[model samples]
Structures are given as structure tokens and as C-alpha cells.
Target: MVRNSRILIVDDVVDNIRVAMNILKEENYEFSFAQNGGEALRLIFEVGESFDLILLDIMMPGLNGFEVCKKLKENPTTQEIPIIFLTAKVDVDSITQGFSMGAVDYITKPFHAAELLSRVATHLELYHSRELLLKHNINLKAKAKHEKNRLLSELEDSQKEMIFILAELMEATSDETGKHIKRVAETSALLAKYHPCLNDEDVDLLYHASPMHDIGKMTIPLEILHKPERYSEDEFSLMKKHTINAYSLLSHSDRKLIKAAAIIAHEHHEKWNGTGYPRGLKGPDIHIYGRIVALADVFDALTHKRHYKEAWKIEDAVAYVLDHRETQFDPELVDIFQEHLDEFITIAISQ
Candidate 1:
């Protein structure tokens, strides 16, 4: 006995509707009644979720049981409420049509109180189980999504820590301090933000990857990096190999940040016009990341004093970059750089 369950009885015969009502009265169930299909639909809609099960009369006047059943099933709000056909027609075709119209079961006229109650109880239990299962599925999906996001965040942090450790190793062996890589990361991110082709995620990737652009410089002799004068032609040739050396160090990693770092390390030296060293990739053939980092590296190099050179004036360094636009940098990137020139200047000056 489901004391809280509600049933709606739709019948043209007043005595039959009263008889069904009386049978359920002893069970402490709630009841609603309608004289025809039209009245049943109106009462159901007006009461809104008032009935858990519907005992529908097939031969009612004005929108008969089949039509009402079809309408109820088509409506999302009432579609899941189970329906049972209470009809005089016992033919196979009528029963089949009733089931097809969304009836859970059919009862011939003069149904026993036991038979009616049994069918109602069975379908209500099934409906309640399905609803519970649906809620459980939704909760499981949310939990799984949250767990997936947590793992991804941890993995990103771990990768970033590893890259920074390697970057600091290179900085320790060179004249430049950590500030050089920090400026490059910030400036590159700003430039990437303004570029239409790079989304927010790409901008973030560039910031982390740009700092490791010179990790290969760790392989160079400290004497060459710390020299008081410009490199000899032979020394310069050897210095260029640090680009290839960097590629060799970081290229093997399958991680996305590391892979991006490898591309920057290998191709940042290559120029847009193909006059640059190493692979000599030209124009669009060179990765956009390499082209982006190239400007950042040179800008930082010119504005900061190294053992081999004094710091250039801000205006002088800006002139050098714009002068080499297509010859050394991506032309469109250079245009974006010019638009955000003041922002880059601020970053370069800070620390």
C-alpha cells in the first residue's frame, strides 16, 4: 500500500468511477476524477504533478483515451507518469493500440479490485526506480568530471615545476639572471594575447614554454657565455649549436609544455627571410611560437647588459626590432608588437 501515491480515474460512467475510488479509499491514497478525456487533461494540467498513475477510459467522448494518451506522452512534464487503460474493449487490436499509446497495462471492464491494485502498484514501483537511477547517473557523471579536472591541474603544476628547475639550471651557468626569462615570458604572453590566432590557452602555453627557450645554453662552456668580448667567428659558430643542443635536450618529451619548449628552442633563431642559422626555416614555415619568442629574446638581449655588451637605450632597442621586421621576425607579429610597444617596454624595465 502506497499511502502517498495519487491516482486519476477518467470514466464516462459515474458508478464505475465511484467504484474504483471506493476500492482505493481503504488504502489511504489520494484521488482525482474526470468525466471525459478533455476533463482529465485539464485537471492533470491544472493540478500539475497531482497524479502518479492514470486509469484512462478508452471510449470517452471529446478527445478519447487514445488521443489523450498520445498528448500526455508527447508532453515532457507528464510523459513519465504511468498510464493504465480501463476499457470494455478486450480485442487484441484494442489492447495492442492501448499499449502503443503509452499504456503500461490494460484492464477489461469489471476489473477485480485486486487486479487493479496489483497493476497500479507494479507500474508505480517501476517508475520510481527509473527516476532514482537517473538521479544516480547524473551524480556519478559530475563526480567523474570533478576528478578528471583535479588530475589535470596536478599534472600541469608538476610539468611547470620541472621546466622551471631546468630553466634555473641554465640561468645559474650564465651571465643573465632569472629576470631575463621572466621578462620574456611576460612580454611573449602580452603579445600573444593581442594576436587573433592565439587563444588564451595558447598564450599561457607560450609564457611557460618561452622561459625554457635557452635551456640548451647549459651545454655551452661557461667561459664562452661569460666572455668579456664578442665571440670569435669560430666561437660564434659553436655558440649557434646551442640551439640544436636545446632541441636535443627537450624534444623527446611527450608533454605539451615541453614539446612547445622544444619547438621554441630549435626554431627561435631561424629568421623569416631564411638568412638565420640552424634549420634556416623561412616565412610561415617556421612555427609561429618560434617567431614570437625570437622577438622577445632579442628585445631582452638588447635592453639588458651582458658581459659582451652594454644595455641599449629603450628607443634604440625598439628601432632595432622594427627595422628587422620581415627579415628576422614574423611581419604580423611585429605589427602587433608595435601596437603594444609601451606594454613591452614596461615589462622589460621591471626587474
Candidate 2:
């Protein structure tokens, strides 16, 4: 295959070109010629990756072969075009310099036609072999990536199903009714979509990750969670541990969604005024994941009926959030949430 490859010849010497062309053409190779490095560059660019190998002469006028080779290596499109120097300079330093400038091999002038043809055939064979190897590597990487993504999708689906079953089971233990975790996930996603710092992928991560916010409640006793009255100091102290429990439950994984879940689990109960439990983290000290979920959880709790109280109207819930913007919630997020209230409500109702 390589003997039949197209070879470009660059030399200022006319006799050398004729001799090499005659010898290589007999071996079934196609030939293109250039008188100097400058003309060779123009011809190579015009051909645009058509030649399999280049035979460059070092001592040509106006941008010698080394200069042409340097330019070709700098261009990603042309860099892989193999170059072999055909030069008269036989010194070790000259040969090393040509190889360093990206020549695959060098043949000194006063060269035998047989030697030139043999070197050309060898380099072309190497080039084709490299091309095959690169193609195989690319195919292998694509297949690996596809398999990884497929497994990731399956893992995410399993987590969602587990969350739904767990959330429903926990809700059954308490007095809450219908889609509490789903609503929080939807609202968190809605708020994140309009957030400047969050991209589409980040928003989706938060959306899926937010439902795990109360996952710690699974560890809390049913009596406390179902209590129809206010929590006693002892019960409240125990309740605070849920945040750490939440973090611990999801913190084991290094995945982005799991990490986001950990942040939400640990920080959602924190207050803007530094009074929140588990950590007295205040204001922007809280992770945006935590801040976003706090609002979602509160809004859903306010608008949904519980064993302890009737649901507040949407208007009343809005007023409550607006009233406590800096005290109970992150004010910037609160404002964005309020601005997109209709979208949030629409998602809530759909859920």
C-alpha cells in the first residue's frame, strides 16, 4: 500500500528530482515536485492532505525545508503529514537537527536511487500504520464513553426510584400527603434554571439531588416526625442531627449529584441570620444547593396540608417568604424565586 502512496519531492536540484521520480515511479508511487521550500509549502497547502509523505531538501532557497517542516508541525491540519529530508548535509548535527524539526528520516545527497526509494517506502508504511492505530484508539474511546454514560443513566434511574419509594414511605410515617419530594425537586430546578451561576447541567443535578434533602428523616423516629404539636427542646436537639445524618447518608459518593445531595442534606436547615442548626453557617456561607432547597422545602411545607395545620394559600406563602427574605432565606435567591413564582407554581401543580 505504501509503495503505491503519493510522495511529494522538494529540491532545488533538477537532476535529483528526475532521478528520484524515475526510480520511485517504477515502484508504483505517484510523484509531485516543488523547486524550493516556499513552492513546496504552496503545493502542499493546495493539495491539502492528499500526499502520504514528503521528501524535503534542507538547503533550498527562501524558507528551507526545516522552516517548512516547522510551519507544517504548527498547523494541526497539516502536522501529521510525514516528512523525510533528502539533503547533502551528512554531519551528525545536521541529521539530528532535521529529525528534531519533525523529519521522520534523512537521506544525504549523492544518494543511490535504491536508498531513496527504500526510505520513502519505509516512512509511508509507518505513516499508514500510525493512522490505523489512531483510528482504533478513537473507536475504543467512543465505545468506552458510551458504555459509561449508559451505566450512569441506569444508576440515576435506580436512585430516583429508591428516593420515590423512600419519600413515600417517610411521608406515610408522618401526616404529609402527595409528592412532597417531587415538588421540592421541581421547585429547586425552577429556581436553578434562572440562576446566573447555574448551567443547564447544574440545574438538572440540583433538581435530581434536591429530593434527597429530607432523606435523613428516615433515621428520625416516627413519633417526632408525626407529632401534631411543637417539638420539645429535647426533640428539637435530636432533630438538628438530621442535617448531619443527611450529609452522612449521601456524602459517601464522589459523583456530582451525590455531592450536591450532601450539601443540601447538611445545609438546608441553616438560617441566613446564622441561627440554623447543625452548623451556624450564615448568609452566603451556605452552599447555593442548600439555600435553594431551603426555600423549596419551606414553600412546599407552607402550601401543603399537614396533620398539625391546614395549608397556607399561595399568596400567604409568598408573603411569608418575602417577609423573611434576609432572616430565613438567602435574599438574592428569594428575589429570583419570587420573580419566577408563576413558573414554580406551574411546576408544583403539574407535579
Candidate 3:
């Protein structure tokens, strides 16, 4: 009793078509009629609407029922439309040919009304059920993809938070204030943005990793780390070891952000002219991450008051960085620093 279902009744005899429609009239289904196989094929092809079940005659002039069924089955567009053969032929070979031609079942002529109604209802119900299942499967897959993305987003946030907490803990061991770490992170990201070779992802990684550049200072003795005056020759030598110490502490991590932090920690103090300690890596030999952070670290340190020195004027800090362009820092990085000095000063003032 599916009122929405559309059924096609095809027969060369007009009386037979009327008989079939009358039998199905109680169900209130929309009906269509074709007098011959050729007309049936044309109706199915030209009609914008689809037929739910096709009741087709086996023998007719111009393209018999078997021929129409075969052609419909061969086409992808109409292949899944169920076809039932209705004919006078009751011979074994006739039924076999009907089945072979993709008919769902053969209903011999003089068929019982109950039998016709039952088979039509059965196939229509099956078709609707199959459609529902396919839609359910599509919805399930979409939900699964959404959940996967949500979990990944949460994991990334947790990783970034852990990195920041660890960097703060390392800073707690020395005279550096937490604000210094924040300013260095901002400055490093700003510099990376202006560098032609770095992409947006690289800039983000530097922003998070620059805070740990002096994590090695945790390894220095508390007395030397907190001293209010310049370090003695021996004291300075021991203090320089913090860079290597920071590297050793973080180098074994497999995470990309942690690896970047380790590189920054190890080489941020290395000079461009090879005069720096702890490997003395110079110029292009120094990792770009290290070179960028080196300039960021010095600029922030110079402008901020610390246990060992009072804060210098912003102008003096700017001049000092410009003077050391190719000796203490990468020339290219120094140029970027000068170009974006206003933005850098804003970051320092903000923190």
C-alpha cells in the first residue's frame, strides 16, 4: 500500500493493461501504460521520473520484452530498476529466457490478483530498505571523519601547553623573568615571518620553541647563574656549557616541535663569525632556527633589566644589534630585524 511508488504496466493489449491497473488500484500507486516494448523503452528513457517496478510483457511487436529488459539491464542508469515479466508463455524455456534477461520474476498470464499485489509490494519494500541502509552508511562515515579531526585538534593543543609549561620551568632556574621568554617567542616568530625562506608553519614552530633557547641555563650553578656582575674567565667558560647541556637534555625527543627547540637551545649563542663557544658553528653552517633565535634572544636581553645589567635604551639596543650584523648574528637576520624594529619594539613593550 505504498501510495508514493510509481509502477509501469507494459502490454500490447489495452485490456490487459487495464486489468493490471485495476488490480493495483486499491494501493493508490501512480500508474503509467505502454502498448508495446518499444513504447515502454521510450517512456522509461524520456520520463524525468523513475519507475519503482516495471511489469513488462514477454511477447510484443518491435523490441520484445526480453530485448527491452536486456537493454535496460546493460545501462547503468536504469540497471537497478526491478523488472517483472508478465506474459502468456508458461514453457520452461520462456521463463528461463525471462530470468536470463534480468527480469526479477516471471508472472504467467491469468495470474492471481493476490499474487501480483504481494510480489509488487515485496520488491518495493526491499528497494526502499536498501536506499535507507546506504544513507545510514554515509552518515556513519561522516561522523567518524569529524571525530578524528576533533581528537587531533585536542592533541595539538595539549602538546603546545606542555611545551610552554616545560619552558617556564627551565626559566625558573635562572634570573630570567617569565616575560623575557614570552617576548623572545614573539620576536622570533616575527622575524621568521619576514624571512623569505620560512613558511607560516615554520614561523609558528619558532614562536613556541624560542622560549626554551636558554633552557641550558638550568644546568649552570645557582651562584653563577644569579651573579650580579660580569663572569670571571673560568666562570664564563662554565656558563657557556649550558648550551650543550640544553641540547643534551632535549635532543632525543622524536616530536618535531621539541626537536626544533633543542636546535634553538644548542646554537642560539653561536656567533656568525665562529667566535662563539659550544661547537662554534658559523654563518650558513648554523641552523636558520638558531640564527633567528640568536638575534631575538640578544635583542630582548639588551632591552630588559637583569640581575647582571640594567636595561639599555631602546635606541642603544637597536644600534648594538645593527653594529654586530655580520659578526655576532646572521647578516640576513640582522637586516630583517632592522626592517621590523618597530614591530619588535611593540612586542617588548607589550610584554
Higher-ranked by lDDT: 1 or 2: 1
What C-alpha lDDT does candidate 3 achieve relative to the native structure?
A: 0.88
Model 1 TM-score, 2 decimals: 0.83
Q: Give me the displacement of residue 180 in model 3, in angstroms.
A: 1.0
Question: lDDT value for candidate 1?
Answer: 0.89
TM-scores of all candidate predictions against the true structure: 0.83, 0.80, 0.73
User: In model 1, which residue pairs have backbone atoms overlapping below 3 Å?
Assistant: none
- Model 3, residue 314: distance off in Å is 1.4
lDDT of 2 at 345: 75
Model 3 stretches with alpha carbons more than 4 Å out? 1-3, 6-25, 28-112, 228-256, 270-287
Measured on C-alpha atoms, candidate 2 has an lDDT of 0.85
Per-residue lDDT over 147-211 for candidate 3, one digit per residue giving the tens place of the 0 to 100 score: 99999878767777887887788778877878898999999999999999999999999998888
Comparing 1 with 2 on TM-score, the higher-scoring candidate is 1
Question: Could you tell me which 10 consecutive residues in candidate 2 have the lowest summed lDDT?
Answer: 169-178
Candidate 1 lDDT over 82-159, as tens digits, reads: 999989999999999999988999887897999887888888788778878999999999999999999999999888
Name the candidate that leads on TM-score: 1
Number of clashes found in candidate 1:
0
TM-score of structure candidate 2:
0.80
